[model samples]
Target: MRHFLRPTVALLFAALALLTHRAHPAEHAVVITTTSTLGAAAQAVGGDSVSVETILPPGSCPGHFDLEPAQVRRLLACELFLRHDFQSFLDGRLLANGVARDRIAALPAAGGLCVPDTFVALGRAAAEALAVRLPGETEALRTRAEALAHEAQTRGNTLLARTARLRGKPVAGALHQAAFLRWLGLDVRCVLPGGDDPTPGAVSRALTEIRATGALAIVGNVPSGRRLPSTLASRGPPLVMFDNFPPSPRACRLLGHARPQRRPPARRAPRIAPCRTRSSPSPTSPSATPAGHCWTTSRLRSHAAVSPPCSAPTAPVRPHCCACSTANSHPPPAPAVSSAPIRPHSTGAAARRGVAESA
Candidate 1:
């Protein structure tokens, strides 16, 4: 009876210790991240032991964001600060004033996409950073990080398999997410200029690039183009739009995760030859290729390079170019292909619908 009593008393003590460990919160480490994706990674890795905050709002562009004083104070007080190297160093300068400099951690410079692999990588980085700062919780943080990484990698693999059909499709994109789209196997034809409305010349150049590439869809940040839709593939591809970023750790709402009504495929064979107009031409600029009849027409129709009004009087449009010679006298080249064109990155900007498969 005495021996049994001793064993029961030992068991009771062990059980009580276990309960205390479970019931009490561990030391909490406050972490600050530049983006929500990183913030979520920190949260996943930190689990119940860390507090995570992101300075940037969801869907905001990193290039345009500025740090506020309150955020600066929070940043200076944080136990750990995580960011991607591509993020502006302005925040770093603010945090590096003293002993706080040691707290700053940057994941390797990457495209900073919200892909599953990216999230997993970020998780690993955060775990490693926190392990250094809070050595007591090292084991738990590492375990959580590994679990997150494995789960993310598994989902990423599935997404790749689902989107495998999109490979080699020529698509235009904003410079911001171009690398990710290319990784998904889309032939990125041209990278659009980033930020708000571009100038007329910029728009014209974009049009020229699109015509040159014969891209079928313009996949990019929504609101990328200045005078798109009407001036863009009006008679061609429908604009495919996507929002900038997911608001949470969950997969993007559209793209591979959700079944947004798929845009019907438009199969087109654009035959517009590249046109090189001189500042001033003597009647004979390059003519339509032997394979083409007439190449391009635009809303701003009359440039010198264009031929006179279309002989088809009631035709929907006439040809035009500025300051060039037209010898064959077939109307100036009208843009041959109607393809979807996407927009550049803007936080508040209504971005394009994503490839139906990405961040």
Candidate 2:
């Protein structure tokens, strides 16, 4: 039975797996992108017409990313590839693997994606490129691109207006964050030399510039690594990090409105019943023991074999007992045991004692 059960279960699982695979077949053409920004843009424009996948991890820096065999396979299988100009790895390594130039789309923008104008331009460019490959959804893609661009512009304007008072405030930051900070209307005092790890001389120079300019904040690029010289941060101002790549094109809509963290519900204290004794009839009875008095060990052991007292409301009164006190007047004695008979010892001195005696 056990042997048959194992094979039967395996067959059932295999059938379930087959049904699941057939239930949802691959429907959309795969689109591969070097960074999340490209993937997001493609998703915004392409909609359900295409499936977008990013080669680079969301938290990784483009310069630091190393391509794997799986990523190469993905690029080879994808119908379209999207990338930015700064991603040199594609040119040196990835594109060399028989991936044609016609399939690739580059988003070359002078300003950061966070800037309204640049964002709109990127969306429009992405729409145009994607519409060429996915012709059936051209009108829908164009409409979505226009809507996305409009949203970005409106939100960017509102954010800019809110921070208008900080238009000319001096700020030190990474080169990558300069465009976004400038778009937000801050005066970029000095650009940090390196991405994550800068040389000692560069850090000293940046620190000197920050101190001289009296920069109020240091903005860092999230993808490039949100780290700066300790001396610069300590002596200068607060370090603020801005992400270069959003998780999705629509992700910018969530900016400024931080999702409130959900806290766990408060726990309740357990209820404890009041202790009672055999003498107590009720909590309020005059003859009952005081409130904290409890049944002792001896009291519990003595009444273990005996029935509950008549004083207890649940216990029935005996026929002979007229009063409840008579039931508890005397406790029953413990059971006695008989000992074995003593035998006479065979030794000479032990015989006189009539029992075995130790020397």
Candidate 3:
């Protein structure tokens, strides 16, 4: 009886320890992301057990965000950290700042889990990692997530439908939101050239090409410099801006509209002409006479011997010294002058004179 009692008491103690380990709150101190999407999922699974904080504020660009020292201190106190794969900037920073690898749970790698799907998967993973069953709210959170996904899909479909009406039209976007635009079946014309905040020259060139190709719209991601859209707006096409990471409800609203906002034309600088030079004709020119004879001081000097008698003008004696004599003898009714400068070597007298003398 003593031996049986000892074995029974040992088994009871072991069982109690297991239950305490499972139910202990600090044993699973979780740091879900501060970003609302992931934070919501953590809450879905953690229920009343875990603490979460989003590292960034609303409307901040995740990629360019910097971490606060207080957030780092909070991260050090956490027992478990869950992050969305490939999208959590804070997760990368935390890991780089000496967070243990095993303490983190990366979401499953599969398509179709864009946002809401991700939230559901995260809840399941977090519950499993903590070695505890999720509270009753797990099913409710899943149902809510599914409903949100359905709503997103419906909105996505509506945008796709509107885009389908205009086939083969070009569209433009900043780098981060290029995929979203392509997913909607719009032809991305030119990527916003160089740097997160595109330069005015780059924007101008892109808009010029877009206008030339008659692109239907310009799409940009949020957290981007306002200058990009403002610059685009001054040009012809309307712009549609979307969110990059942790997409917002406003993105849905913008997607539904699909129509570009009207903006005043961008002011452009005036173009200037290149510098050049021009030469003027000589002051002593030829004068018309009876019988249609004309003589200039330069022409007369070159052909002193064969000059037509200024009075008789007998067929304007062909000036033997220059090729101009032929045109003089058979002058056209109306002569046209070319703007091209006549070179000294190309003159009729220069050609007729002895080569050595001319040179």
Evaluate model 3: give its lDDT.
Answer: 0.40
Q: What's the lDDT of the predicted structure labeled candidate 1?
A: 0.48
Name the candidate, 2 or 3, with the larger lDDT value: 2
lDDT by residue for model 2 over 1-359, one digit each (tens)? Answer: 99999999999999999987654333365777765556655666666666766664333455554566666666777778777767655665656887777778777777765555665566678778877777766787788777656555555455555456778888886787687667667789888777455567767788888888878777665555544534466656755445454322222211212111111223422111111122213211112111001011110100100112112222211211000011122321111101222121211232323211210
Instruction: Please give the range of 10 consecutive residues that has the lowest summed lDDT in model 1.
Output: 283-292
- Compared with the true structure, model 2 gives a TM-score of 0.61
Q: Relative to the unseen true structure, what is the C-alpha lDDT of residue 326 in candidate 2, on a scale of 0 to 100?
A: 16
TM-score of 1: 0.59
Comparing 1 and 2 by lDDT, which wins?
2
Worst ten-residue run, lDDT, model 2?
A: 298-307
What ranges in model 3 sit over 4 Å off?
1-29, 40-51, 84-98, 106-169, 194-200, 245-359
lDDT of 1 by residue, 99-160 (tens): 26668888763542534455566667878999988888899888877766555555445445
Q: What is the lDDT of residue 46 in candidate 1?
A: 78
Cα-based lDDT at residue 317, candidate 3: 26
TM-score of each: 0.59, 0.61, 0.48
For residues 1-359, write the lDDT of model 3, one tens digit per residue.
99999999999999999899877754345554634345434544444455544454323443454556655666676766655576565566777888777676655524322222333454456456544323433454344434433434454344345346444557766665455445545577766653444576777677787777766666554445445655775676655444332211111111111111111123422111011012111111111000001112211111100112222222222212211111222222211111222222222342324322321
Please give the CA lDDT of all the candidate structures. 0.48, 0.49, 0.40
Ranking by lDDT: 2, 1, 3
